[model samples]
Target: MKQMTTIGWREWASLPDWGIVIRAKADTGAKSSAIDCSSIEELAGDRVRFTLRLSLKSNETLTLETPIAMRKHVRSSTGHGHDRIFVETTLELGGAEKKILVSLTCRKRMNHRMLLGREALAGSFLVDSSVDHWATPRVKKALK
Candidate 1:
């Protein structure tokens, strides 16, 4: 088997498209990844604009419009289905970078600002659920 980078249940990753680092929860159970955003607006030409919330405790946010990859019907843990807008962007994590499709959602109640699911973890990472940050450097003040 190929060597895979081990990451903790929570780790810091970068979304260069928005110029900020995100704290992501590595959820192997979730098939698709999601990001916390608000004020979602769909523009002409298949693009979506929204405010990317950096943290639930802070007021930090970035309003951006990125090209839409596709929209998918997602079922929450409560068994309710909702259509989510997916945007393709560059994700930097564990010393590797790739363009990934991330769905925009309201994750204010969730512990982490971003949820890194199995689709984004496949072939790239192995989650060590017992640790908080086993790999990757903690990024600070990406905006400053």
Candidate 2:
């Protein structure tokens, strides 16, 4: 049997490829995960380049270029549909690394920079919403 790790409603995660640590919300209600990005430009051969703003106050940003996994039309909680660019990347969470599909969207208004959805959590995690940072120690070690 696979040992599923327990995570909280919110947790810290690292995107090693982008060299950034971000706070992510484990939302079981969402079907697909999303990442906050700005100035997304589609390149040739189904590739995209974008700048990820780590902090809203800081001027620092990480630029990344990756092939598009797919373009998905996601409906929001407000029943609004949006076409988002999807990309596959390595997500380091709870000392476990998995390649997951992430959609790039403007999330300035959201509390967390990243949202870990059902697809990313399937067969891997069991959420304990009452707790927070269940994997902080492990995640910190993985980041170092």
Candidate 3:
């Protein structure tokens, strides 16, 4: 039997390609992870550009562009449905990095900027909701 790494309900992660770090929530209930963004614009040839706010309290931001991995119809908790754009990016979780598909959306109302869904967590982690930020320190050092 192989041992799996356990992660907290919330941890710090980064999209290293864009040099942005965000607090993420591990949500097994969600099938796909999401990132908060503003100014989402669709480009020609199946590409997208958006501005990511590093944190709610920070004025700093990063603009990124990536080819569309796919488009997904996502239903919100309030039963509202939205067509979200999915893009591939490398996410550094704890000390490990992996390429994950993340849907871009407006998450201004959400507590965390990012949500780590089951697909991103599969085979790589075990969630322990009782803990928080177990991977943040390691991720911070790697990002530096």
Pitting candidate 2 against candidate 3, the one with the higher TM-score is: 2
Off by over 4 Å in 2: 137-144
lDDT of 3 at 73: 98
Estimate candidate 3's alpha-carbon lDDT, on a 0 to 1 scale. 0.83
Residue pair clashes in candidate 1: none
Better of 1 and 3 by TM-score: 1
Between prediction 1 and prediction 3, which has the larger lDDT? 1
| RMSD list, candidates in order | 2.0, 2.7, 2.7
Q: What's the lDDT for all of these models?
A: 0.85, 0.85, 0.83
**Which lDDT tens digits does candidate 2 get at residues 34-84?**
988999999999999998767656656788999999998999868999999
Clashes of each: 0, 0, 0
- TM for every model, in the order presented, reads 0.92, 0.91, 0.89
Off by over 4 Å in 1: 137-144
**What TM-score, to 2 decimals, does candidate 2 have?**
0.91
Reference-based TM-score, model 3 = 0.89
lDDT of 3 by residue, 27-144 (tens): 9999899988899999999999998766767666778888999998998767889999999989877677788999999888888888999999888888999988776654543311
Candidate 2, residue 144: lDDT: 15
* lDDT assessment of candidate 1: 0.85
Worst 10 residues of 1 by lDDT: 135-144
